[model samples]
Target: MDAILNLRENAARQGEKTLTRPTREEAEAAVRTLLLWAGENPDREGLLDTPKRVAKSYGELFSGYNESPEEVLGTTFEEVSGYNDPVLVKDIPFFSHCEHHMVPIIGKAHIAYLPDDRVVGLSKIGRLVDVFGRRLQTQESITAQIADAMDTILHPRGVAVMIEAEHLCMSMRGVKKQGSTTITTTFRGTYRDDANAQARFMTMIRLG
Candidate 1:
């Protein structure tokens, strides 16, 4: 609960000011250290530029750390008179790196919220996913993050978030099932307390 509150507060703080962190050269040097530690020659013909490439890739992959979904979600339109039904964005695919192993987590997210007055733009839903997805994450934290972000920014009556993903860490190492997927969900407000609302969200996401 405290963690989620911190995230919400952090989201609110975004767009207000910039936060400083490590430099790209420092990140590249770290990656090079990992290469050397992995017993790979960082100076080899093929690997000579690998660190720079990795640094650039890492910039793109974890860029979410520098962004806030609340900024993207801040815009809204209240033209939704008499249309207070739950708004849903389903089968939205995203790519995230697992914080546990720094490997890919390929997934689709299903997001829904029962509106109070206003609604956000459709693409903003995907943008919200990208904002959270570009950071290293666990499925559970990401689930709560999405729903919480929506609840905070949209001030909705309820919010629901479900993420289904295959973690490369699970598939490429450890027990290595190679095909298992993990699903996590978070619900808030009416979605958390209303069974009917929860079932409707599930049914809508599953619709053909």
Candidate 2:
């Protein structure tokens, strides 16, 4: 049991270390290289400052890569007016980049959690989504990360997250499915074990 606990602690430490931001210069150089790889001259008049601009833009877009979702969810409110119901925050807008193609994945996320003894501010849910979404990631990882963050911080009875996104890599380049959207979901604890609870959460999001 001690060994298991130690291992878990080590893993958590490693996860914390992974949350770091890149230096501005590094981001700029990467953007420059990307432009060159795309057969564009980074030195061209119109493209001269493009690398810096892209780097700055990436600092905002991928800022989540440096942020800890657990940290973002640290503060909780105990006063809930005796409301012991599932807290649902839906249709939170998000933008992410596909790690594979580096193209945009634009979407909305629906999140719900059943509190155990504590509940987070409603805006925190949206902020949590942004913290994970503003990075180069897969939809699967993004969905799972949000669910895991809520589960860990809130220690809730259950957590559920669903993301619906359209990938520009597919729609703008390969196969070009313009109107197609991909849906990904992750559920923890009761959200996974109870069908009715999951169905109700999904229904609420769909209706809205």
Candidate 3:
């Protein structure tokens, strides 16, 4: 299990490349180019400020890249009086952009971790979701990253993550299936080994 997790982490690191980020002015100029590509005049009265607005919006939308999951999940509470059960946070609403189309992927994530000794704040779980959700991602990568972060940081007995989202790339473009939703899940350690554990996690999500 550790080896698998290490491989995943290594692969993720290998996939990352350092690139100099563009200045806000440069970003706005790029937005203007995109507007032109979309067959719109950037200098039009109504569109004059659109590039600046888009640049500002992108800063907020992709802020996840500036955050560190280790910082978010590093702190844990060990004061619980032998309380070691599945701690689940469900229906955490998130908005992400698909890596392929840069369109919206609106979804909710359900996360559960069977703690070995310590647990993180419930709100931290929600924040953890945002830490990944605010970046370009696929639902599958988000699901796996959440579960992996929980297992790796908290040293949990198990971790379960389920994300259900509607990808605009598919709904608005390809198939044009407006309401179609995609679901992805990741289970680690005990949840992966025990069917009952997985079932209990699902039950908790459903009951929530």
Question: Which candidate ranks first by TM-score, i.e. highest?
Answer: 3
Task: Give the runs in model 3 whose Cα sits over 4 Å from its true position.
Answer: 1-12, 15-17
Tens digits of per-residue lDDT for model 2, 1-208: 3323434554687884323335778878888898999999999999999988987787688777566667778899888778778888999999999999989999999999998878888888999988888877899999998998898778999999999999999999989999899999989999999999999999989883
Ranking by TM-score: 3, 1, 2
Error of 2 at 106 (Å): 0.4
Q: Candidate 1, residue 37: CA error in Å?
A: 1.7
Better of 1 and 2 by lDDT: 1
- Model 2 root-mean-square deviation: 5.8
lDDT of 3 by residue, 1-208 (tens): 3323544565678895434456789989999999999999999999999988998898789877767789899899999999988888899999999999999999899999888988899999999999899988988899999988888888999999999999999999988999988989889999999999999988988992
| Superior by TM-score: candidate 1 or candidate 3 | 3
* lDDT against the true structure, each candidate: 0.88, 0.85, 0.88
Q: How many steric clashes does model 3 contain?
A: 0
Prediction 1 global C-alpha lDDT: 0.88
Q: Estimate each model's TM-score.
A: 0.88, 0.85, 0.92
Comparing candidate 2 with candidate 3, which one achieves the higher lDDT? 3
What is the TM-score of candidate 3?
0.92
